[model samples]
Target chain A: MHTLIVIDRPPYGSWSGRESLDMAFSLAAFDQPVSLLFVGEGVLWLSQRQDASAIAQKSVERNLKAAAIFGIEALMADQSACQRFGLGDGTLIDGVETVTDLRVTMRRYDHVVFPG
Target chain B: MHTLHIVSKSPGHPRFLECLSMVDTNDVVLLTGNGVVALADSSIEVPSPLYALEGDIQARALTPDSARCQVIGFDDMVALTIQSQRVISW
Candidate 1:
């Protein structure tokens, strides 16, 4: 089944965003086709530089980089969310695609998962 | 019915017990973030086959073996999610 994991929260101060990616990685590991959609404050997760060491937390950027190893190549961010957050493609990490319409994009997947 | 229970907070957090209470014998419990630290403490009783994320373990510097729960990566968590009929996160 093709699953679209949605991340609507930012990377820091909360575990929702990283946990959502963990769910994506898990689904992709079982050879299930999975994609990631970052919206709302979640667009910030794609920031080019996330130094979490001082906070005594694992670098979320490292986890984001590991997506490819799990065979997850379809990473996307909501275009509107990016603009609202003043983040563009250039400010995000490499390989993140921006989608114009999330509603339209969500319909393509068999299931849409939200990190709880 | 097998359920996948996820706890993302430290122990003593209201949601931790709430998540644990929801688990059945066959359910799978996955601990992440701050919750991983609590899982490492031997005193707390875990109900089912428990798992902790490797990244969270490393981040907290907690030994998975000490906690007596299986240390799993994202892939293992994915497999567990697929096997369960329902999932509840806290």
Candidate 2:
């Protein structure tokens, strides 16, 4: 079964999003099919050059870079949310796909979970 | 229906808007907890075939419009979940 982990919270401000990312990695480690969908403020996690150092936190961008290496299937962002957040082709991190129809995209997975 | 979207956040929450955006015409929306507040908020445009938990409506003292939303008890909510091919809790 394909599991879709949806994160709608911004990174750094809360640990729930990070925890969700960790869960995705865990599922990947076990050879489970899992993909992540970022919507609302969660799309901010896909932005490039996020320097969390000043905030004394490890950058989520750095952690997400390892998602592919960890065998996570896909990293998706809501297109409208990306637009609202000003995340475009040049600003988003590499390998993140922006999806237009979220309802259709979500139905592809057997399970959908949200961060805290 | 294709999908059942369960929303527990208030209408003012960003996730509530996100949930609304993801709703398809064939999909059904169930309001629980703070989500039932949407029934009273006139500005929020809820989708058709909407449902609000009866307990939530009572707890919040909200009188949802009978025409616009169907109030369901726990058993009915479970039935709705079983009827849908997919369920997304937002």
- Best prediction by lDDT: 2
Docking class of 1: incorrect
Candidate 2, superposed: residue stretches over 4 Å from native: A29-31, A79-91, A114-116
- Tell me how each candidate scores on DockQ against the true complex: 0.03, 0.49
RMSD of 2: 3.0
**Candidate number of the best DockQ:** 2
lDDT of 2 by residue, B1-90 (tens): 478889989988878887898887798999998999999999988899999999989988888889989999999999998898877877
In order, the Cα lDDT scores of the candidates are 0.77, 0.89
B1-90, model 1: which lDDT tens digit per residue?
Answer: 466767787887655764576566777788988888776677887665788899999987776664468888999989987887666555
Against the hidden reference, what TM-scores do the models get?
Answer: 0.56, 0.78
Maximum-TM-score candidate: 2
Worst 10 residues of 1 chain A by lDDT: A103-112
